[model samples]
Target: MAEAVAAGRAASRGVPGRSASGRSRHARILAALVALSALVYAASSLLRLRAFQASTYDLVIFDQALRSYSRFGAPVAMVKGVHNGFGPDFSVLGDHFSPILAVLAPLYWLHDGPETLLVAQAVLFALAAVPVWRYAARRFGPVSAHLVAGAYALSWPIAEALAFDFHEVAFVPLLSALLVERYDAGRRVQAALAAAGLLMVKEDMGLLLVGFGFFLLARRGERRAGAAYAAAGIAATWASSRVLISLFGGDNDYYWAYGSLGDGMADAAVRVLTHPWILPGAVGSPPVKLLTMALLVVPLLLLPLRSPLALAALPLLAERMLADRFPNWWEPGYHYNAFIVAILVMAAVDGAYRLRGRRPPAALTRLRPVAALRRSRPVAALRRMRPWRALRRHLPAAALLAGAVVTVPFFAFGDLADPGLYRPDGRDRAAGAAVAAVPDGALVETANNLGPALSARTRVLLWDREPRGAPWVVADIGRHTFPFTTLEEQRHRVARLINEGYRPVFRQAGYIVLTRESAAPR
Candidate 1:
């Protein structure tokens, strides 16, 4: 008995239990995978940079924030004093704080401009791949992990979302990572915290959180935890609504005309139910249409047989289907659902591989005759081990390559249409020239195009306010309109400025810059 025990110990030690050499090799493989992921992300980032042209809307919004940050240490509510507000009032709690702006504060401090902030956003987006990979790896093995990360990093929707400098959209990946992490750990508290953080990151994330919460509660049978989540979600929704209403000064412009929550619910239901075809429209093409449908239905078909991953994917699918009230179907910014789609695809691929038969490729059957002869001895044993070893060593690399091939094309060739809100005309150039010609600290009144540009250089009156040193006023052209001035109004405003001792020193496509006339002193 003692000899047998000694033999067992010796066998255990000789069996190479989790060898350091093997571990070192695994670490190297993981490192290579991570490095490859970074390379792909870097390539995607470079591509995005090339593809991205600063849109007029982004410039207008970013310039407003930058000007506010530079002058008042806060984002200006309006360009000119009329209807100046912060935050999206239409969505619950949509406009309380500009999350991206707050995060970009450091970047602003480094080099205060929209270009700097855009770069910062791109960098944050790239970094999101790490957590995404971790989430995939934990559930589906390192192979699926690398694939999911690469797919997410290069996704078209994420690339397009960068155009708007939108704060709400960035939360998709961040919140997804947190949800995946907490769900994997089976920690209710951490999950709740993640949910709350997601909601705080953006109001739309609340829909994601609610869907995920119900999914978790249903799957895990955690009644108390689920109840807590439901309660918190309700409270957050209410609080966000109240805060938004107050911020917008009871203006219901952002909200639908439904007078109450019940009416809003009815409206939301009508929007979704009546517009079933919006799903295909949202995806924008037949291929994407097919892909989107496959993504939703495929995993669900697998749910009865495989629960964990399907559970994770269900919330994402539900969020996309339920939140259909967005303004445009093809609007690239609304493509936040791509993150969900990517995750679900990865889950489906993982399930497929997991369900695959544990057998050698059929091509090996040609060698079956030789193997039959070899099976009379030890040679067949070696042949059986070879396939397993090959699979173990190369699976992750193969999966990564396959995922890249499937998903990279979307980002590489996605359509970007112009939204025609800004002009490339000589207006900006003229405005810049006018500001440059103005005397330092000159009191100036300029159009919208000129105001933000001049705000940094001099005290510009936006809406015909009395010039205090460097005071910028958004000119109130009656009924709270500024640059949307009719031809008649534009002529009147220009004439009035001239009569008030302002001289046009520079003219651009859409704006005229005027400095206080030398004849008039403060």
Candidate 2:
């Protein structure tokens, strides 16, 4: 009986029982992670619903793009010339990076409303935490992995990015996961394909690919694979830029005034160098700034010392910071660095765990005595040793920590709060309703200010251009100045429409709708 028991103990260690049970445990943990991810997504969706009240300029661009896509079936690149006549001709290439539009196209078909798109975006951003968590867990132990994931999901930059509808930032988790997978597989072609996909998503994604590739070469000494990755990354970057130029080159109004190519390149370099310094100001309020700074810095300091992963995040972070300088200095609108920030935090946590020690628990030491007893009296040894029992003791604390980190942020600030009335509320609702009331195939002209509202129904036409068989001409009565700031310019545009035989059909606060007369006066 003793010998039989000893054989059973050895058999358990050989594979079947231990390996199968471990896999089952892992699956259960992953399921719990998925459930947590779903909850976070739901919370983000609710917040987005409440926040998308005010009509922003970007919304107008997206609305127009969607309307044009609905009408023309053209990709974003082909729709460069259809500006609302404000400042620059809006290009889909400028806003809807290919990957983002790819995701949004399906949502557009499902809901066909900007509000629905916003909700979908929030959910996508929230679900990004899953890949991040998995990556962290694979690199670090469960304790540190949960901490890294929690920090990323609840980070202030991510929160702000979600609040604003910047799709560029949403690609971070996907990019991180792709890099990790490519590194592990040692497949240059797959890595290149992933890099290409990211480049098409956003021009800045090239920087991430470069940084990641460089880190792989520098640390792993996988020079051949790294060279291929870098080469592919550069090629992909060039291709995306060429595509954008080809799409928008013919339109004189599509010029980017940020800077010349050389100057822009130089400015981009400077922005990356100054990014960490600007973190304090980007959060706006001092308290939030300090807290944010602490969170960012702490993880960075913890990044595994001199590891390639630590260095890989630098270029991407720098590039995002540099890009932010061209349009504005440290503004929330350009908070694309949130992706790199989360990655940096993960690296820091991974570094911290590695620095401390990578060792299994000491209860495994009891296995020696148990093995000795097993050779003599296997039944007694089984009673004396319980490896599963020791493992179970540590699992609860790790799970509890993960749960607390994920849950605390949700309870504290996850609810939909009023971000003031500028979202998709009263005015947006009224505008959408008014646009829906208009008949299809209507030519709409609005004061520049009402473009977001007017865009909801049909495309706008300037007075110089004849209505392209459109039945309704909705005119904006707000204002037009340097940045469409004066009401008089709006009045002038309105007067021009009236002179052109378009009659006012509907008037609301700060807006007026005009339709073409059935009979033109001779």
TM-score of 2: 0.63
Residue-level lDDT of model 1, residues 150-253, one tens digit each, is 55555555655553343344545655665655555566577666666666654335455554556557654665655665566656655555565456344333
Scored against the true structure, residue 291 in model 1 reaches a CA lDDT of 56
| C-alpha RMSD (angstroms) for model 2 | 11.3
List ranges where model 1 is wrong by over 4 Å: 1-52, 59-75, 80-104, 187-189, 221-223, 244-263, 266-326, 329-335, 338-522
lDDT of 2 by residue, 1-522 (tens): 232233223222322233666544543444444445445554554444343322334444555566446554543321123333322344566543454455565556665555554555555455444445555555543434444555555655565555544354566665565555454445556656656666766655666776776766875467776676667666666555545545543332233332321254456347636665554343343243344334444434534343556666666544333332333323333345466654565555545545543454567646887556556765566546787445543342244235335533443234444344335655555555555556654554433334444444455433223233334655445323223446676577567667767677677644566766463321
lDDT of each: 0.47, 0.49
Q: Give candidate 1's whole-model lDDT.
A: 0.47
- For residue 101, what is the lDDT in candidate 2? 55
